[model samples]
Target: MDRPTNPTLIILAFFAIYVIWGSTYLLNKIAVTELPAFMLAGLRFVVAGILILIIAKIMRLHILINWRQFFNTIIAGFLFLSFGNGVVVWALKFVDSGFAALEISAQPLLILLLMRVLQGKKIQLMSVVGVVLGFIGIYLLVSQKEIIRQEGSVLGMFLIFLAMLSWGYGSLFVSKADLPKNYLVNTGYQMLTGGGLMLLFSPIIGEKWTSPVSWSTEVQLSMLLLILFGSIVAFTAFNYLLQVVSPEKVATSTYVNPIIALILGWYFLDEQITLQSIIAAIVLLTGVYFINTRKKLVLFSRFSGKLSENK
Candidate 1:
């Protein structure tokens, strides 16, 4: 029989995913300004992965999986973290944190279209409307002359678009992929493999590595917050919520994350949130809401939920 869940824990879990995950954008923005993007992301995930495994070990949770599960975790890790997240971190060099978050808010729409193309799943009428609005919102957001004219801004936006594709495909893959039974172990493996890959690629792409001891106090604190709260605590809470609450309720992070990110970015980073951007955010998020209106479309898989968090 299933044990009863505490309401307080549920609320706390929701807070972690909602607030902590949203704030990761600002954290990454701060760190990337001073550190090499891949290096920063790689170190963050590798350290977070180690800590998660340690915690799991202390709890005596199963930490070993078959070779197949290990291999699949690597693939999922590459798609979701190495490309989906690492590339986005690189893009942050040119784009505002809030802008990136707003653009990424269209992830559900991408998943819907990917389902049509890859899986031959029919898009429902409401979802079709969502796809249209999502595109319009994207166009509005990207068409701003001042934003696009910035050096490397177009490239950043393009890379972010590619990251969305990777994340969308990763979501579909994880939904059907063979993974470890324990959610914590599954996440640790993905982070470990993904972060390892980034560390390997960082030097090859000519990104300089620096010791963390030399980082500015702000960057150091950002990395610590990212590893501890953004990756581990928020993700654990996400998995906990998945078990206790309805997936749709858990998926509400889709609507809240970008808003939180926008507000935090504006306040802390002094990133501009223009009126046009606001309109675009509304249109884009409304589309996400429609696409997710069907319970069947909710990204209920623990991995996909993590993807939705945009961490």
Candidate 2:
């Protein structure tokens, strides 16, 4: 099927990514409440992975996967999904949901920093500014009186940063890695590797699969929503944008997701949204603009020369 090439589709795709991905934190909170965190996420990926594979089959998508691709995807999956994402579920066991959300929001800063350090990429000027603003925003947002009292959450906040650092670095690897060009195939492999690892870890961590194996309808429904929206729809939208938009533009969704997360946190969990969080929101978006659009901030980026050679 020929994909639609319109401003509308592009805009919708961006929005879907922005809002849907952002709300995933709250979903994790709810799902974790009734279900084991790692196990729940594991089941989610397993279900979503199968569903995506099924859909890919129906669409007859071409998958030119090699053994090396599977291994690469598995490694990428283990790093990005299991460690990057799975850490959130693990940390949430001991932290406030909102605080966890905020910490994860700091990913772009970590990504930019890591890229410069690990990949020898030059830092974009605007992204540098964005990181500054993002930190300021975090400070402001964290001013809620009760949250201020939780020192351990500060530690947990740092842990989530580590999670996102892994996520951001993994994203770079995703861009550079040789794998199936088909998005579904890449995602399927990632889901399997990461999901499988989490399940494996669950047993080691003493994740008892719980007595009365039959799950409640609520758990079943949550699983369905995660598979359909979080896994299938959000990932498809993400991959589609990779083809249609500049990565910088698609990355703006990083900023957009936090707002969605904040709002969803407010709506579903009735979590208090403080005035400081609003101030922080502005700072965060500014940082996001800098982070994703740093190329524009760099005069040298337009030179089209080797950024490394200059450095």
Candidate 3:
């Protein structure tokens, strides 16, 4: 008899992206304390982009392109990487890791709305339900914040919300952009061009890279891990999964990241994760599962196929 097939690699890869990437919000917070925020993130992409470009060339990834594709890549990069991610890093200066997590958790909902507007896909019933439930959950979580006495936290919250929307807009472009054949190579250019643009804009934003700052050995190690694991490895794995999996499945990682961020915030920062937050996280995650898997459930029932959804 033939040996049984296993999904061990898929499972491990899923966990690696889910858990490792999820924990990165706290890591990013720590990283900014030691280094300039935008500059630090800028450096991360600069390095990761170069590595990806080198690897793609060595693998003969065939990234040659026409002018239209070139323009598309830069546009997508500026929107997705520069505006989306740059805003998040900038907001982190005033936002707590948990607060940031709650706000950025809105990306899935934002993406849902964007898809409706951009593609005119009819919003399924459960999707609307899921969106409502997820937002309620996040609203509850934010209410549990203990550090919001000042107006700055409110402003920070607004900024984080903007960051999520920016990122969601970027995702919309990524889905709709007509670009080269290889998505990974496109990601390389996206990171490089967007990150380079961010570097150029850092001074405009008054990001003083040469400003002296305190550093911890742990923070240094964390930055290294983020540049390698979070920026390079996780993103490549993410794009790989995107190629192999459904868009809805890939979207689960967005919801999952906040859970991990919440945990790290509680464990390391001693930021209180209230009973309401715990319940809210569960609600949001449940909503995400429903949003992503409901269509598959309906299809499986119709075809009499057992569910084989992997994300």
Candidate 4:
């Protein structure tokens, strides 16, 4: 029999990824109220990266890697952070945090597609169903007259879609790429690389901090939270979970994240949650569940059949 999971560890990890990551959307939205998108993201990662590296060193853990591994980490960082996170941060200027979370919840569907297209992974029957349901959910979310009527909303949603795609690709790429054996070390390098790139482009893009020193307490707190909880704690928990649990299970956190994000967004940001969005959240999460759970479901069906035959 498989070893039972430590309930405490599971709870803590789940709390980290589900609640911490979910809150990031709203916190990011708040942070951008005064900070430029690239600058906010760049500083968040750089600080988080340095902090993590320092922690690893203090713990006497290995943090060294060769040049090739460093390069790979940098590429993965740019894909995952610069484009994935950076664009999403920029898009938040137009999209509501709740809506953005709902859209980003589509990451699993995109990841599966990228795997099939790039790595030639076989597409299962339930996978097809999941993809179709995901598309239907997207249509439901975006097809509303209000969203369609507003050009900025449409553009924001499109940008979010691109961000999701970039994130998915980066995730799959990192899974296959060579990096430091320690997940924390690899992640630290990635953050440093991606953050450096963001800082580099910030000036080129004319992203200015209009009132960096005068940022409100809320924005300042939001940025600090993103750096500490979102980047450091949640990400470390996620990476550690990948080593302990099946990635399918890890990915399931995406389903819970949107619900938390919606609640937070509504409560704190006073963001509206429409009926269509509610339906979309259900449909999309259902599709994601189908995609992530299909393997276990197949095994359960086979076990049930054997039990029936024995009876």
Among these predicted structures, which one has the highest lDDT?
1
Question: All models: lDDT?
Answer: 0.93, 0.76, 0.74, 0.88
TM-score of 3: 0.84
Q: Where in model 2 is the C-alpha error above 4 Å?
A: 1-12, 141-145, 211-213, 245-249, 294-311
Backbone N/Cα/C clashes per model: 0, 1, 0, 0
What is the descending lDDT order?
1, 4, 2, 3
What lDDT score is found at residue 190 in candidate 3? 78
Estimate the TM-score of every prediction.
0.93, 0.84, 0.84, 0.90
Error of 3 at 265 (Å): 2.1
Task: Tell me model 1's lDDT, rounded to 2 decimals.
Answer: 0.93
Q: List the residue pairs that clash in candidate 4.
A: none
lDDT tens per residue, model 2, 1-311: 65567888777788779877776777787777777877888777876777777788888987557898888888888778788878787776666566576666777777788888888998766777888988887777665666767656665666677788888878888788888788787788789778988888888988868532477776676677777888888888888898887787777776677777778877888877777777777777778677767346345565646766688
Residues 118-212, candidate 4: write the lDDT tens digits.
Answer: 99999777778789999999889988886667658888999999988889989888888888988788889989999989989998999875555
Worst 10 residues of 4 by lDDT: 292-301
Better of 2 and 3 by lDDT: 2
After the best TM-score superposition of candidate 2, give how far the Cα of residue 95 lies from its true spot, in angstroms.
3.6
TM-score of 4: 0.90
